[model samples]
Target: MAFVQLLVTSLLILVTKADVAIDIENASSDVYWIGILANPGLPIPSNGGFVLNGGQTTTVSVPDNWVGRFWARTGCDSGTNTCQTGDCRNGVECAGNGGAPPVTLVEITIKGDGGQDFYDISLVDGFNVKASIQPIDGTGDCSTAECESDVNAACPEQLKDGDYACYSSCAKFNTDQYCCRNELNFHSLMIIISPRVPLKFQMITVV
Candidate 1:
């Protein structure tokens, strides 16, 4: 058996710090998906978006003395240099050629024995995300005893105003385990709206 870890991030710009809204348009049949709004800003118009199913199973088995963890951060239109050209711009009214919006982040997590798990969205670092798994019923499924610090803990922070940040990491496994058992894949997306992009939305679904 083997252990698996997945990370996903999304970015967007909020017009103000009051309105925040995202309309979950659709998802895959086999998997469960939810929408996350970050930064506690102004809710925007629900323009219809979706989270596709990775078309994969999330259950399997693990070897003795084996343990694993996964984490992810999302939501940025683009980096500084290339942002002005693509969806990262998010359809804002700008005077110059490269018009982009502010970046936001979301964190997600799932623990042991994949049987329809949900990682609640929380605030870690200035709209950044942090996710972890703990022993359910005070006894997680593992042959040997494990520690919390041993799990993945990579939470990124906001850099300067115009710079993009990427913070991610994973914990080491004691032995090989089946990835199929209780597995969780991720599908990331970006919503770009502007006079140029014209509501061009892009999504990448994976398991």
Candidate 2:
């Protein structure tokens, strides 16, 4: 997946050292199974996954230094515990496993250098849904990272995964250039969004 390197600076204000509060909501009409993947040795919230019905919201707490990613799995079967998109292949709880490609991701790192938190929305895997992240009651430059557009509507015919999700060129073709494998700088991988569509949000690196 594409990675965005965020730069965070020290703040003069006294930052309270506590677990970070993450509020997740399902803004769409479809039922969503929220998946969590934490860094190795870190705790995975909600045992790695949970279900969120339409318009439902839930909160999860993570340590100040937690590092992880979150995504939503759609078209899941309750009996089989599988999903048409973003399935981890191990049932509802990913148990630290990441979602399948062609899924939207919200990546985060809490309390890094100088007590700054870093976050971004990545489509390097591809776009399955419109997703966003907003900081609530935080200090310093806490900007929202989001992609509000319906990318699936403009997804190229070749990149479409049925009618449910869109695949990144790299995921579909596995070419070095599309995957940024040729680049020596590992931090700035280039993701190619279809030029035929107008993206509503630029991939953001926020502190």
Whole-model Cα lDDT of every candidate shown, in order: 0.22, 0.70
lDDT tens digits, residue span 1-207, model 1? 122222223111111111211112111232222222211221211221122243422222222222221112123122331221112222221112211222222222223246322222221111122222222322234222111121112222222222232211111111112111123223332322224423222221111
- Per-candidate TM vs. native? 0.20, 0.81
**Model 1 CA deviation exceeding 4 Å by range:** 1-57, 73-128, 139-207
Predicted structure 1: lDDT: 0.22
Question: Which residue pairs in model 2 clash with each other?
Answer: none
Q: Which candidate is the best by lDDT?
A: 2
Q: Lowest-scoring 10 consecutive residues by lDDT in candidate 2?
A: 6-15
